[model samples]
Target: MSTGFDREQGEFARGARAAVVYPDLGGSSRDADARLEETAGLALAIGIQVEDRLAFRLRQPKPGTLIGSGQVETLAEAVRDQELQLVVFDASLSAVQQRNLEGALGCKVIDRTGLILEIFGERARTAEGRLQVELAHLDYQAGRLVRSWTHLERQRGGFGFLGGPGETQIEADRRLIRDRMARLRKDLEQVSRTRSLHRERRQRAPWPVIALVGYTNAGKSTLFNRLTGSDVMAENLLFATLDPTLRQIALPGIDKAILSDTVGFVSELPTQLVAAFKATLEEVITADLLIHVRDVSHPDSEAQRDDVEAVLADIGVAETTPRIEAWNKIDLLDEERRAALSAETAQRDGVMAVSAATGQGIEALRTMMAQRLTAGHRRFVVRLDPSDGAGAAWLHQHGEVLDHWVEDDAAFYEIRMAAQDHDRFLARQDR
Candidate 1:
């Protein structure tokens, strides 16, 4: 299948003819500005050069264009003047509103969710990632399928029986999309099951799994690459690494552990997206440790952190789960200010300040991560009689054994593992 950009036949080459519009529907103007920044970030990520931007303080949204007929007319002139091929709204649009906006602007109109979905579609590389993106795209389009593909009906081909009845085109298309969605869901389920199997296998390995998560463009990918010494496309753009990537890293004083970098979270993420990306985020939910990487240099860093934590909770990653807050981009601050912030961070539990780009405070951060990750584990050496070798094997399966040496009396095993592993080991000994 062709990528979304390819399907456009190089329409995005001169750069996605684009504009950003937002409704100043109350709240702080600073918030509205931050949202525009986010939309700009999205434009940058999708290779779209934002030609123009329109924002207004609206008393209430119009049902047709979402802003108002007058505003739509003004935006239409801007779209024409800018020769925009796409109008990206900073807010979610209803099906009718999206179609009406396109008709008014004489260009493709996409909501924030749709734009982000397109970005994900183009960036998805792995098979599982592609399938998940397709699933999310289909689910998103399923609701507004009529508005998006209505123009396709005018195309003529020898496509006969596949076309079905002209009058039932909408319903027929809906059924086709629904059927495809069902199949994609099943495939994703298989993908999820396979991932779970891998996780189970990893559980028996000698290392713990650490997941890195945060808001988009918060530098999680950069930090992941910095720690793992592997190139995984650490860009300054949003959603640069859509697929979750993992690498092995040895900590300062602890054994090796698998460090996974998952996709970033965003404020007011569409529910359809959350549902579709569950398979991808399962890596975070099941991780033994979570490293919440925050861009402390961002103006809305605190709000972004809240948004990420909220999404993590919504995704069923228990708040009680152990997490380390990595306040990144400290080098972006002035020396005095950075020092002040670092002192403040020292007062916070399980929090550290670092810079992924400059490699400042990275060693200390890694040591903190390693210590917190293995906080409860204790080392033990156990001997198993010949008759209990099977039970000893079970112990090894459940714990990380640092070494194994055999003696004539018994098989000696040295392990460093969680307290639960020790309990299970003791139970096996009794049996």
Candidate 2:
């Protein structure tokens, strides 16, 4: 028996033999083979045993199955021959189409959105992460309740003899889901408020914020660990890190910076998740500098870069936000290819070639970051009264005091700081 839920495990059981069906709609820029490989990687990430894979040219989508009847038969035969327990579609499937496919193939069926949700549900660990995942899951499920409980549609007569309207089980279930979603939204608002306050506090501090973003399994966590010297779960799997992590690290010529490792982006990230995790992604939006880490060795590196940028745009990241690209995993390339890439990176203004695993080019990357952070700073000379010890100390603590001296009852000082910091200091003095 194929079981979607495992009672003993307290979670969905993976390891079921599965088959992947990639529907190649025309005009897509992504290479079909690379998309297939990525879908397989997602399957492997969840411990699913992929037994067969096939790609079909989808000239037009079938409303019932999203594929032609002949292709559906072919997939059914493949499932039977491979003895697959699950069938995964690389494209989105409507709830009715999913149900029809499961019935036709005699196995469990899920779409790209469902698979991503399952992976996120399994990987989220923190309270906030879990909450976001649950909210997204509920939102996705609310639309599928009709297919989930088909038997509940058979309505009975009204409770009273007056023949009043009767509520079907599906309607009641949907109402319950809607109510729960409202409560979850309320809770999430509180969480967002708390996070906003924390971000405000960090803004008041002296350190700059640098966020790391990239496609899934793009070695972001690896680069983050190399930079921050913290042991986060840097594994070679898709969506390995779901919760956002922040650590303080010192940059060359800079006292400290807050480096954030965020959840990696994938092509076609679920809309439900995008809405639910807005609070978590606020860090990326508010970052002073963004480090876009790319796995340069991947065959579809360019496509992955585009996908990451698309997600960033969806999250409302301004086009003017300062960003630097780190071409990581140089160690994975051949010497010849590595040298070629090195040359290419040199030609780019804000790009660096680095291998986080080998500590190669990390120093150069750090220097670049420090330079960008301090690029627009200005130097100012101000006179202060010697008795005003607090103002003098504040300037020393907040900005780089280039030189200081006291002449009679007056104190002469020079300081270098970012333009914004200087304005903030002046505002503070006025108060």
Best by TM-score: 2
Candidate 2 lDDT tens digits, 393-429? 7787566788999888789888887888888877876
Error of 1 at 137 (Å): 1.1
lDDT of 2: 0.82
- The regions of model 2 sitting more than 4 angstroms off are 1-12, 147-172, 384-393, 403-413, 428-431
Q: Considering summed lDDT, which 10 consecutive residues are worst modelled in model 2?
A: 156-165
Please give the CA lDDT of all the candidate structures. 0.78, 0.82
Clashes counted in candidate 2 amount to 0
